[model samples]
Target: MAEERQRIRVEFAYDGGPYHGWAKQPGLPTVQAALEDALAMIIRQPIATVVAGRTDAGVHANQQVVHADIPADIWATVPRNAPLAPAPAMLRRLNGVLAKDHPGIIVHQIQEVPRVFDARFSAVRREYSYQIADGLARWNPLYRHIRWQHREELNVEHMNIGAQDLLGLHDFLSFCRPRPHSTTIRTLEELSFSRLPDGAIKARIIADAFCHNMVRALIAACVQVGAGQRPPAWLGERLAAAERTSETKLAPAHGLVLEKVSYPSCEQWAARAEQTRARRDS
Candidate 1:
């Protein structure tokens, strides 16, 4: 038998404010719907997509990768009647359709990857950046889609110290939105804060995987600590409790952006990735 044709991987970026979320819905606009529609037009088939992260509505993605399995024989049929090649041109074409079909969404890039590569499971680390514009005049019109405007003075030093507590493996129940029968264990590789010259603060978080609303809530908790509303050790205590509580507020999704996703370097972790997928499906 011939070797199975691998799934074609596609990376795209989008402003998630208009769509309900990443998943497809009955009557609501979604990123999945927009992409699937564009894929159907491009490949002339019923295409299904698996995303790296299912970002909440109003969240943004600087880099979101997805995979779709298309037939090897179908490559010849792709509309090559454009200036750019099939993959790149498809992005342009998809953007055009998005401009007409799904407003306020764009496909940045598309590429092919190995068959075993899974967009979600293959990811080893996912990075998210949240921007806060503090004491700002005219905020970045370009960054408005992916930033939160907080005029209040923030103690960046305090926030940095609090963020350091979040590093390493922990049961992040406090930061995560509770899910019935779901494990909240995650390994946070990095959590750091940076102060920009324009008086904006940027919070960057890297994790193997994130539970629902974890990053936003983490930022909220850190912000509270920075503002003196909560003590710096409060997050550490909350993590120790492993109790799911709403005491921590979830920051607005507009400020969050999916920055990048790093995949596993070895095959040993494939089993864990597979298990993660199975758990998500279940």
Candidate 2:
């Protein structure tokens, strides 16, 4: 008989500057490759992980989620030395292995989860934040990797006004990079802008799921409105068009961060995953 398996849920964060992206790619360093390699080293077997959200290159993740399945017996052996539990042992061991090479990625938490818990389909919402240092005064070399340096000062009020029109369920094809067999229809739960104490403008975006380039493109369009280059109503018009336009540019990926991914209670995991899968398939 095949060995019984256990599903593990992992919560982690990474600085995406050093990696290609979250997905593993041939001959290129990626967050997934680094993570899987570390996990394999500890487990003494190859391991694959499914991420909650696949971020683009240069996009950081403050809190990313993933789930993996491994042999239950092997998992029990993780805490070989100290009195630590398997989950904590795996966390320390993986971080130790990663620190030797991939220090930018950190595993914050790990636990055995129900088989029904899927990192991707079980997720109810994903939150992202973008930072912009508009004007020279707000620019800081220390945060260059995390914040976008914009030439023009942005009007937070205008950005908020423009963002309101993009909220709710709609086809965001104009903002998303087209992908085969993927849907651009998304429910944007929240989109708002505010200025930080340090004078940097921050954008918070929450959605059920995002298509490729959707968040950055939305940022670019709203920034134009904030900078007075486009009228606030132009954002609504773009959504109505349902097609990509040259005017809608993609913001730099570095400014975007995946802040959180929320899931329902354990009992609801299976139902949520099934619902999401059915929606995607339809």
Candidate 3:
């Protein structure tokens, strides 16, 4: 049975505010549990999911993808093998199961992908967004755990200048939590800010990979620059220094959202489709 097994890939999204993060915790609800529970109901067996990123609590995912190994026998029980139906119809059933138990969780799409297509390692880029509402309005209850409220006026120009320093490949020791097996090296592809219609400011960042708490720490540094407490040029120096200094502060987790994940063009789409078909038809 293991020899005939194939991997299943799924794209999902969630509001992370109420959970203890993406992974399962001993005493807290998590996105993983919700997904696994739904999968168990569908397949009539325990299911484990592997995510692209184990986002911290209060961090939302606009579109996150995960992969799991499902027996071909299980896949065959769905749409394609059903008297006569297209493969896409399977997604609807999966969503229905997920929606019943996981409120606020949405399964956007599901399809089988190559065994080599690891949700984490195969990802080419990850984009994140952070919202900051300046002044008293940032304290509004509606925005709790989603927006960072700053009661001080900010100098956007200075913040932009500081963020520019993080645009290239560099060792991000200062912004990351030190982990023994961690590599602080990463290439930042893009970073910029824009004002929202509601007078809140948002920081958009994209990178090949991020270190633990890297985005939060980067935002915290930017806030210091915006508030005139840190020189705008200091960010550039920190990126070059590759040193973790005591002054580095990780921003609050609530303000960050995992916006998207990118991958190489689907040259292997044909292979994936064929494998998917076999699993569904078997």
TM-scores across all candidates?
A: 0.87, 0.98, 0.88
How are the candidates ranked when ordered by TM-score, highest leading?
2, 3, 1
For 176-218, candidate 2 gives per-residue lDDT tens digits of 9978888889999999999899999999999999999999999
**1 against 3, candidate with superior TM-score:** 3
Kindly list the per-residue Cα lDDT of model 3 for residues 1-282, writing each as its tens digit: 245766877888899888888889888899898888888877788878888778888889999989888777767776644553323555777788877767778888787776777777667789999999887854677886789888886788899988888888788998888667567778898878778888788999999778888998899898988889889998888787777888788778889999998776567545544553343244
Each candidate: what lDDT? 0.80, 0.94, 0.81
How much lDDT does candidate 2 score? 0.94
Q: What lDDT tens digits, residue by residue, belong to model 1 across residues 22-97?
A: 9999999899999898878877878898888889988888889898887766654455765555566666777787
Q: Model 2 clash pairs? A: none
Each candidate: how many clashes? Answer: 0, 0, 0
RMSD (CA, Å), candidate 3 to true, equals: 6.1
Evaluate model 3: give its lDDT: 0.81
Better of 2 and 3 by TM-score: 2
- Superposing all C-alpha atoms, what RMSD in Å does each candidate have to the true structure? 3.1, 0.9, 6.1
